[model samples]
Target: MGEQQIPDATDPASVEPEPQRGLSRRGLMGLALGAGAAGVALGAGGGVVGGIALGRDQAQAATDAVAPASGIHQPGITTPVQDHLHFAAYDMMARTTRDDLAELLADWTYAATRMMQGLDVSATGAVGGSPEAPPDDTGEALGLPASNLTITFGFGPSLFDSRFGLEGQRPAGLERLPAFLGDDLDPLRSDGDLCIQACADDPQVAVHAIRNLSRIAFGRATIRWSQLGFGRTSKTTSDQATPRNLFGYKDGTANILADDTAALDENVWVSASEGPAWLAGGSYLVARRIAMLIETWDRTRLAEQDRVVGRDKAKGAPLSGGDEFTAPDFAAVGSSGKPAIDARSHVRLAHPDNNGGIRILRRGYNFVDGTTDLGRLNAGLFFLSFQKSPDSFITLQRALSTDAMGEYLRHVGSGLWAVPPAPAAGASVGAGLLGA
Candidate 1:
């Protein structure tokens, strides 16, 4: 959590560039221009180009917007939730060295700083560079505002392998998550060596961030799996309204708020006393690609739906409560002599009070990827949470294993990552661990 001066952005000494690839500068520029023209032409018939161009113009007309890229903690963790998200997991190539990994982080940090400020990745930018040279940035976001973009990076347990001589630097608590009941996890989408979370108010801005970063990692890393999400399902700040999930129920009604510093320190940030000095102020990220069985849930009666969630759908209030934020009277009796809120309801089972008083910062989003092979809608919540320790999540999930709501949900893809503290003003992410 110590502060240090960041290198001057104008000085090329701040970050080491990757070795040039086979494409000559002139050839790269020519190819890039050709691609740009083709994209414009493709958008011409639908008026897409005009629309986006207008959007860019409008964005530029406003005052420049920015999100601080450095602080005591990463921006995306506690920053107000954005409307769109682009989450990607990557695997480092076998031949990549420790130096390669360190340089990549530094380069990423520099680019992130510029992008967050509404500038291009490098001085050459998307256009106006040498006619033959490859453009430093993809031009899609050329006319867009910063849209409060924040890019957060994390290291998975797999990254601590012999390949990078980083085996000893792994945090003692970083490990593959334990399997839970009813977890139908797919190995292909389950784990990765590293991950990046790009969030912004504009969908295009979010996509562009991930696209450019992936391009930067060309030989050193390859994307394992990625997800695009919209309609944020949770709010990190008190000012934002709680968003709903695919189930049509308001989600994250009682989530941790950005202004709740005390709760955040206790539940989200790791202290130096926790050990692994490098992770101080850092947090653990848990992502679950949960697929909702809409058909089954749709067939159930409204009464049963309310019972399953232990809340009134229309009001999002506890069945035995006064309102949305009212404490659930778990012991209240119904007119029929049964417990008002069922003992196995999701709210009761997953409540922190029942799970050793642990809470997590939820930053999830809703997703829909067309239809499944069986003709059902392939839709669900991309559940994301950050916590001081993985055990907090582990304990809460174990209690939910037997919750009635589990019937309509399936855990397909999963990942756990160690999110390091934010870099100093001039430092790149992971600088502490990499000793860059």
Candidate 2:
């Protein structure tokens, strides 16, 4: 019943891991690297695009608490939102066939499974693999524990095109998101054919997951865009407190809890009755990179800010009055002969009471991307939401079209993806859809 632990990087007990079924690789395993191999790796720089040493030593995952990776659902979706995230979008290579895609998923699932269990992608990790070739893992985390890592994968709308012969299997509800009110979308950062969301308590672990995965995808797929985020803006468990967004407002205060199976089934999981059998138990993932205009909002009066969010900034309580957890009394009126909570307030607009009882599971984070060229702080919220159908998110977003808070926000990037269920043991992700 005690917590499971992984072998240390230098442990002699470690041995080579078998390749997942149908996963054939070029390099040999279990051959120790020599001084010359070390020398070669030292000369290599971190950039894979350049001809440098990537320091990719496929070693055991040095981690602390381990997060279970194999389950009915993908790990990061309902798992307690981690403290850091490394999210990347990828596009399948040109002229690639269905087999290529399936192989890629198989490889990814194998590596992800190992990493989540606090092991390297392969058994002969880091220095244990043939030293002549590049290491299977990027060795930055050799001594680090898994740090409760979770890797979640998603298939974007583009992947369902004729190229994969998945057109007929596309769900009726899966499509590109409609244009929102204040969208200033960046084409380069917008959509992709696939995406991977890596989250962990330790930032390096999250980054390491994506780095290794991207390396695995060298010939088959390329990264479209990626984002690093910290300071979770939402929680999936009741034990976690409501985290704040860049705006300093407590975000996702009424979010669905991890233990609320009833709500999760209703709002997050796609049921068999929903159709498109391949994605029956999965959910739709919607990501929006929302750039917050803090300078403008900072200049606004405090009282006006409360009116905009319909909640007291300090207590995170409804302006109509109660504690942080108190449901907003949207019907209450202020002495000014108007509703206490502004008509366009975010709380009222996004509340399930106002949105036809529709709710989405949020897993967002605050981001500060250094500074803009103009010297202003480049900061915002990386909003992530999971729902049974895309329509739920679209409806909520549409209701916020004229939100008073809209004046201080701009959505720069967006993507909608179908998050498939976790693969069964020894099977790769999307095996159901790929017929693997």
lDDT of each: 0.75, 0.76
Backbone N/Cα/C clashes per model: 5, 15
Which residue ranges in model 1 land beyond 4 Å of their true spot? 3-63, 68-70
List TM-score per model, in order. 0.87, 0.87
| Tens digit of per-residue lDDT, candidate 2, span 40-111 | 011111111001111224322234377643246777888899999999999988888887787677667666
Which lDDT value does model 2 have at 220? 70
Note the residue pairs that clash in candidate 1: 6-426, 25-132, 25-133, 26-132, 29-133
Provide the lowest-lDDT 10-residue window in model 2.
Answer: 35-44
Native-vs-model 2 lDDT?
0.76
